[model samples]
Target: MTHIVLVIDDDEERARTAAEQVTDLDWDTDALDVTVLHVFTDNVEGATISQFGPAREARDVLEAAGVDVTLAETSGDPADKIVTYAADEDADVICLSGRKRSPAGKAVFGSVSQSVMLNSDRPVLFCPPE
Candidate 1:
């Protein structure tokens, strides 16, 4: 059976890195599928997935690795959308690229990663930006 890895990230270079790292770790798997998910909150600038370059790059990376890759996007609360999609898909693993934020910033802007970690019952892999 193929394992499904759901990767949630914003359009950042670090997001690509997280996807790359996850793919590298599972390079030897007999079958693997990766779904790159970009959740666009009200704060996001674009409505289309094409606007998310890094997420597309991450999808390309997985595709080049012979892994089945799917790119998807949805507009809503980032954390809520991510967790809901993961659960709905019955994803084997969920990967997130984390960013550093001050307490004040987190309070004002909210942290999607934190919310996902706290709410998701599935295994969540937090990848810190290098």
Candidate 2:
């Protein structure tokens, strides 16, 4: 059976790192399928390939690992879109790079990682930035 892993990130390097970490974990022996999702909340028209550089980098990482990869982009709340995509894809796991933020920071800016972790029914892997 093939397991689908969803990797979400706004930055190219962090997205790549998250996918790499998932590959390193060896969570399952079955074939792995990965989808790197990027959510554009606003200025959707302005979104360019450069904005999704992270998704592309992540695709390379997963592809190099022999995992089938699909990259997707959409416009919506980042956390909501991530959770919805996981459900829509029947993803086995959702992985993302988590930033260490202070309580005030989280309260003020809100944390995408936190929202996804709380909202997702599937297992969420928070890979701290290295």
Candidate 3:
């Protein structure tokens, strides 16, 4: 069965690099399809522009690497969208970059990585930023 790898990231550069890393691992493209889903939270008006650039860059990176990928841009809370997209796609594995948040930040706002780990049924790969 083909493995569908879903990469959930908010940072465009990191997301693209992560996808490239996966491809560099020599995973068979024919057997593994990598999908890069860039989650953006744009509750206020005219907020999408900030998020759109990165997503597009990430998509470009994946395409340049010759990996079969689908780029999706959705507006909402990041963690919620990531979970929903993974479940909806029935992904075989979900890949994400782990960020080190300050204690105050964590207390005020929960981590997306933590949420995905808790909610996703499929394997979740947390790639620390390099």
lDDT of 3 by residue, 1-130 (tens): 3444445555666766666566666666667666667655644545453356555665566667666766665667777787788788888878877667898897788888888888878788777766
The candidate, 2 or 3, that scores higher on lDDT is: 2
Candidate 2: minimum summed lDDT over ten consecutive residues — where?
A: 1-10
lDDT scores for all predictions?
0.76, 0.76, 0.68
Q: Which candidate ranks first by TM-score, i.e. highest?
A: 2
lDDT for model 3, on a 0 to 1 scale? 0.68
Ranking by TM-score: 2, 1, 3
Off by over 4 Å in 2: 27-30, 44-51
Clashing pairs in 2: 12-54
| List of clashing residue pairs for candidate 3 | none
Cα RMSDs, all models? 2.4, 2.2, 3.0
Backbone-clash count (model 1): 0
> TM-score per candidate, in order?
0.84, 0.86, 0.77
